[model samples]
Target: MTTPVQLYVYDLSNGLAKRLSLSLTGKQIDGIWHTSVVVFGREIFYGQGILETRPGQSHHGKPLHMIDIGETAIDEDTFNEYLAEISQHYTADKYHLLDFNCNSFTNDVIGFLTGGSIPSWIKDLPSDFLSTPFGAALRPTIDNMFRRPIPGAAPTPATLQPSPAATQAAVNASPNPALAASLLQAVASQAFSPSASVNGTGSSAPAPATQPQTSSSTSTVSAPVHICTNPSSFHSLLRSHRAVIAMFTSATCGPCRMIEPVFEDLAWSKTHGVGKDRVAFVKIDMGVGLGSQVASEFSVRVTPTFLFLLDEQKTYEFKGADSSELRSQTDLLLFQAFPPHPHTKLSFPAVEALSSEPILFTQVPALDSVISKLASFVDGSSSPSETVAAKEKLSQSFPVYLKARFPANKGAQPPKNLSANPQLIASWAEATRTIASVLPAAQLFPLVDLWRLSLLDQPIATWCSAATSQTNPVHIFMSKAIDALHTADMSARNTVLVTLRLLANATSNTALVRSLLSAAGHRAETTKVLVSSLLHADASVRTAAASLAFNVAAYLQKGRMDRLRGDSSAAGMEVEEDGDWEVELVSAVLEALSNETHSEEVGTSFRAAA
Candidate 1:
């Protein structure tokens, strides 16, 4: 049964936007759009993650307009499955007013359900807001409004609104087990947050994207907290940070001036785990004002003095201008603050040397052939001829967009924004979903090949790499390929080869890689595919399988190394699961190596995996 899909659009400004937008932004905006998809007897939206309510029953009240974009053949159970997959990405913390908002979520959902999009006037509002002087000026304010709560301000009505999933046990749980473990350790040691409860949630939203400029610091680059004239502010910093590295200096001190830059650089070094809420670097100018009072309290008499505090207790103090010593002591403090996994102490030189670059099969086939093959697949399906037209449109326009965005010259830099025509994006997404669903596993190579090339581009990769997308073409395609691998057919073998290449390209997104590998059933199926394909009769299949193994191994190896260095960025899998993964991967590689004879290429790839 085809279910009707309606786009329920609400004006967030309550009709004030139409009255004031022109004066404020120098643009005549229709309304501030807050949209939801109404389908399968429910109104679905993204706010505090994926939410659903009875049609016309949401707290937003009745929508200003509801457009019947189209209908979807997707059943209720399948749609729920889709929701479960995409929910993690659409958390309340991830929501933003500009870069990714309710409209973005609706657009993704609409594209999946009906192969259509939300109205352009609604979809283009964020960009339209950004194009104006007032809007551009307010970008930071808008971001901060959503990113963090104002200090000491009363909670707003929106903040107090209960999530629909508040009753769910996992609502308060950390998605990643390793992260939860780290949090527990930090809480137990009273190093991370002394007052923070084990179940508490804090604002760790990513900083908003800045407008294009000659230079701008990214969200990862953090500035040191300064306590130039305030002695009281130092205590707050000490309470908040797990470890505080305070540099006490005076303006007149020559050595103090020399080491200020070094202190600032340490705060910005992401490799040192400087950013986020993990560690804080402070600069205190004690030459004048209450800075002298702070200096007196700490009994700092030297021109350049360093104080290292863990959980507000002084662990180390030094009086000098030694840059190397500063770095070494900072590293030591962080190591104590965040101890490494025991696995880091073990040796794995071969895994250490493996290339981390994703093995992308970038060879673009003749466009005419690829498109014609795709058209044939569409023709075989129950889809309309327009589906073929959409597929052709994507095949022609996507490559052009990629070329314009990423030129052949090594020095060329594309705009950070992946602002292709919305129609092209919609068509590409619809076509991918259609092809993956209708095409048999044996005949999936051409579409898989195109997808592999598409993943090389940032926009497509970003969209597809989400473990659960509106359409989830990548996950669906991967599942299909893995299932087909159990068969002995030659065509299945061919499909698996291309599928492995596609998997390799997916490794470019670390989060996506972790998401795919972390699922127990998916990981088991993938292991079976790799093990069987490694021993396949065809050398190409074996080589492709080996290449995929290398990518997965490299990813796991890097995660292990990150943990060793006290970098929590790659912490996702549980400790036991991570150990099991290494053992299983190594066993597969050894099993394949024992039977290898026909091709040295396969051996080399397997050796890389080993």
Candidate 2:
């Protein structure tokens, strides 16, 4: 799997670059000039002055150091937005020669990403200058340069980097006493600076400082409490979440309005502490047309009534504007939900984005040519006999080919040179798509065996950027395919699990993620199947499930924060309840991670993911 975190460091001539005027003529400076964080090799996260973290392009110098900060908990969208929020103060327009520069931005980003920061030297560079006699004398010139954005740099009003949702870095350093002592001595030796002793990258000398300097991570955003107008929809919300506190009141009721703000605040998704469940707080205006009917259904006769629902069933109800009673019932709601899931909680954005980038099919004939062979079955222009024969031929021959290619021989391997066969991983994906497009469970099952074989392992189950195939027909048809798999024979069921596992790791494209999300109508049941498969009796199936857990968790962490901030584009995303499929999936993963009875690989994976 690709590393989720990397350090993109750039040295502006190590204190002797284009801004030399500020360094030499203005203030004495030490260490490098700029640095940034890169996540999933997909985006460059750095402070550029003003608010815009340069999108995907990297104009900065080659990274001097690329540290693997393990898999990050936050996704790119969240990190980017965090940068946007941080610009409130860390604007490029306010760039300081020594004080708040690119270094500070990097520190803040590291904090957000891994709950760590660069060593003190990198962070306290300005402090170093301020402490010196000459530093105080040159403050004006340095501050002037900082206040003035470099001519070619970001225009005024650009800013970024914020502190939020963080914990101490989990980077593991070797436990060598000498190394530890030397590191302490090194810090002591650098007596000039007490603010920070780690290297510019937060690495300790004579030792790779794997431990990221700790920093506070608190997100300033979360999904707002929503309004429910429809009665059935509100009931569904109650049933769907672990705890839902519905505020029932009419427009004519004064207490409802008085308690409105408080309800909104309490309903907010962020509770400011670890694992606090964000209750579903909803308001029902009974004075409206549907309110009275809803009131009758819930048997509410009083104004300012609060209904505490646990698992779609109401366990408690409060009447009147007594805020104390309302809060007490909410507390009872949490108490029943119980167990207090700290980190291993339902994060819906992560659930929604649990997909690999689809491998874009950019090649022309390579992609189309393969589909050409099977497209005939879909169009029905071919004679029924021809179609039947083609299916049988594929069913019989493809699996044999896969077995030969991957070889059951444990020590056997695919050719050093790649396959030129049409079933080369590239053509296989096209074939899978063609079969899926051909439609009808009866027709597709014939080839499911072959498809399943392709997913077994090795050089078989995979794809390459074979053509301009951005969309996977399988992804689009996944729901139906999964539904079909459920009723199929044991082999077919196993095959689907294996194929999904392969897809999770095999493609570099997001087509899979897109398909899963777009077909969200089917996600609940589908998620259930996958989560259940994690504990299947089949060892291979369990292995596949575990791998998928990693992928799902990684993908989820990348996009969660943005979704929580109520990004309009992510409007309908909802966190699953305690027993919900998504919640079960996360809990299963966390359990597997903590389960010492399991294999080392699973335990290690969960620990890393954590």
Candidate 3:
């Protein structure tokens, strides 16, 4: 015959106890069975029992009692006595009494004592429950019982107060808002003074009071100013003053070591400025642990990180190792800190002085004699051969002036080799090109030929580099060259176009728009050729052309609209008959017009006319 066993389980955290049942037979006794017991506040509250059984109906069919435990309403003493009886009857091997609070035991015993299931809350028990210096100790037998994994034991609620060490750790981890607010207020209340005592002896003294004091007003009179000493206070001072100089450095950094003296000198000199009270100098030492933390917060990877905080919001940073470099950086920071007055214009005293220099015209004996001879030769009518002879003689005697003014040497030797002197070559080309425009065509061709040969073998990148140099005016020369090439023979035109196409494609040259505009009118034929080239077979070339066309259209619409209006032929042409270039140009104007749509009809009409 078989009977069902009723198992009871208890949960302490939720204060709920539940019961379950399973059937068991004689043959199934050898197999494992699982159940649970629950304890709360050092007392076992309930026990659960589990059993395994084979499938069958009892012959008696009297609802056989497979296993029966008496009521779970037993108190602690009765429960312990029952546990002992069960433990002895099962030889401490077959049956088990599991205690979650015990220190050492086996899993099977734990499974049998508790039901087959484990409660979720048992995982949070403290490792050491009563091993305190104050003589508190966990019961040894219970500690031994708890060492094993009970199958269905409910966890102990975590109600223990934190240990001293743990509480200290928590306090250290969290920021104290009260302390932070107090520190901030303390910093804000203290002022920063760059007086003679603080920044060395100064010429200017502190301003005296101007307002007259009455007997009643004596209480409102000012008191002595106190300066902030700590770094946080210093930071507050800088914020209030809107100072620019902030040096972030480490004591061990070599660069910081070198620049510290220079910084000190500058800091001392700042007191002499008009806004001495406004200018602040602050240095942070990133050597200590707290400094390292701050450095991490600021994301400062480099030492000697000089930040020129122009205002509270904007900052310019300079990172370097040289003292001289730091000095130069300081100059720029000073410029940012105390910018020039808005109404004041910049002036160069040397240039202004040179403007007043007396002009001198040097007498050239050769040119003077040549002019006289040419005058005499032109005064009389002569045969074609005689005239040609006189002109040939004058041309042969003409002195070629090659006066060149090189840029002042900036503490460097000029390259002696002609091949290396790109600046000189570019400048010479520009001067010759300019002179060619007003000079006779015969004289111009020779200069152009010379420049073409000189630049023939040079790399495109090299040519571009020369063109974009700050000191060289290559755009001006290029403009003239483009103009000359348009009117020149087919070979000359092809040469100039090849050069221009190279310039257009080069990434370095950003002045292409300006150069093209300069070449637009004088080299209309070249412009037409370029515009036609845009429709070529190559995709890259086509893309570049499209971008250029848009850029050119926009630029012309903005800068050369008046010039386009001045053209008499364009004025006569009908709007519909206008070419692709004119259509694109007009489209750009239309787009600009759309933006200014609110203007009155008179304004619109005037804009259209212009």
Candidate 4:
């Protein structure tokens, strides 16, 4: 038979030592050497020692002596006390002792505790542990000792590993053999702690011996939290449970004036939990103000931008406005803030849908005209076929006309009074009424054309301005227009590519433009189309397509990687589960277009029919 070697009690915590005593027998004997006991705590040290017995003594020898291997005096009395306690508890009958002689104190202790046997391999070790397998190998042995029975006791039944809750409780309890054994059993059965208890109980274990909390008030905040001023902070706030709102506005924004009352109402409602926990509405003025730096950090270019933040971070944003629309938006945001019940249907007034049909204008009127000449033209056209065709053409061209004719105060300064003009209000109402009248007939055509036109350079400002009106008709028209424009046809698709280009070049509509690209169906094109568009004559079209394609590809890759992460066999699993790598396709196209060998810059503008 192989000679017995030195014993190791590796990685022994108080709970683990107690568990070993309760579970094992014949663990202590003369001539056995105990070495390398790794204790994970404030102090990290090792001990070298030997257990000696008389030469003629049999396995049942009465006398045993512990000799320190190191030159320094060993605390033999303390060591003997611990051994006697373990021996009396564990009931080790006959065992041979060996002198301690090993590089690692931990390995020796583990070897002794686990019957001087070592497994051929250890599996699934953490990276740090794998770097030093000896330490890692001992963890399982210590773990196994807690799972077994002593010599005279009934063998512990084979069972699943202890649950996190049970293990935590065991670790937290005072070091008593019986208590440790009970805790280990509880952990194994997964009945250690209740869900609420687990969350409420601070860390995995009860407060350690060194640190104890008498009450909730005694606990100190972990860190000094600081608010972020960028888009990342905005996202973080949205995800936070804390109630707060980050309002972004400019001093001279007209729409901001119209919506100020609504914000005040929101703030008031929050105080009563009418909004719950009373929202912390932090106003960040985009104009010259203390928050101007924050606005600049987030690249804020538009005024009246209301960022609905939670916990002082941005969650949702609102810019420009119609009173009813803004009110409805505010209500929806409030609903999100409160959430009646998990299963309850969320309630908020529905905003008007986007329009699909284009407004036909046979005659171009002055910029300030109150009445729409197109309405009379549609009513009076003589030929039925001609009228229908002209109406269809007008529907197509109206968006373009609106885009081209929208006014811009290029050299004018910002308006002093940030309030809506009565004339502007009247014009919006009239325009809405005129557009609503034609919506039913316009539904027959694809709404993509209307959207395409609205995105055009001149029409974008007009569309935005008109859509910002609270008039029901105008809201309805803009909503229907947006709906129609949601999906694109072949020609309209190219026009969209062009529209993106124009918006990117203009730079004023940064937020609006980003929202458009984020909408559905925008990332569905083939790589060829995307790459080809990169060299298109229009600068706006090329840049927009390129940026969008990159973003889409990045989003897809991230989503795929995230999906592949939790499972054990994820490494061998295929990356594309559905075989639709839309992002990858776009990326390939971008790569091809960007390669100077394959493509060149084309200087033509995109001009597909609306």
TM-score of each: 0.51, 0.27, 0.21, 0.22
Please say which candidate is ahead in TM-score: 1 or 2.
1
Per-residue lDDT tens digits for candidate 2, residues 107-132, read 54555566555555454454443332
- RMSD to the true structure for each prediction, in A, is 19.3, 24.9, 39.6, 29.3
Candidate 3, residues 1-610, lDDT tens digits: the string is 2222232222221111111000000011111112222321121111111111111111111121122222223355543443433221121111112222111111122222322212212211221111110001112322222222332221121211223343332122112213322322221111011111111232333322122111221111011111221233334444556565666765357666566666656665553343444555655555531344445555767888766665664366667756676667766666666665553365757433322111111221334454444344344434254444544443342222211111134454434421323333444544443343344332233333323223322331233221322222233334544454446543344334333333333222212223233321113433543444343333333333333343444334433332222222122111112266566444544443344434354233223322
Candidate 1 vs candidate 4: which has greater TM-score?
A: 1
Which run of 10 residues does model 4 get worst, by summed lDDT?
A: 217-226
lDDT (C-alpha, whole model) for all candidates: 0.61, 0.45, 0.33, 0.33
lDDT of 2: 0.45
* Candidate 4 lDDT score at position 471: 38
Candidate achieving higher TM-score, 2 or 4: 2
Best TM-score goes to which candidate?
Answer: 1
* C-alpha lDDT (0 to 100) for residue 127 of candidate 1: 52
Q: Is candidate 1 or candidate 2 better by lDDT?
A: 1
Query: Which residues of candidate 4, in runs, are more than 4 Å off?
Result: 1-409, 417-514, 517-585, 591-600, 603-610
Q: Determine which window of 10 residues in candidate 3 has minimal summed lDDT.
A: 19-28
Deviation (Å) of 312 in candidate 2: 40
What does candidate 4's lDDT look like per residue over 289-375, in tens digits? 124556766566677665555554456665675556555665666666665544234443331121212212122224222123343
Residue-level lDDT of model 1, residues 179-281, one tens digit each, is 3233223211221111111111432232222221111111111223333334445665565568889888764677875776777777656323322355777
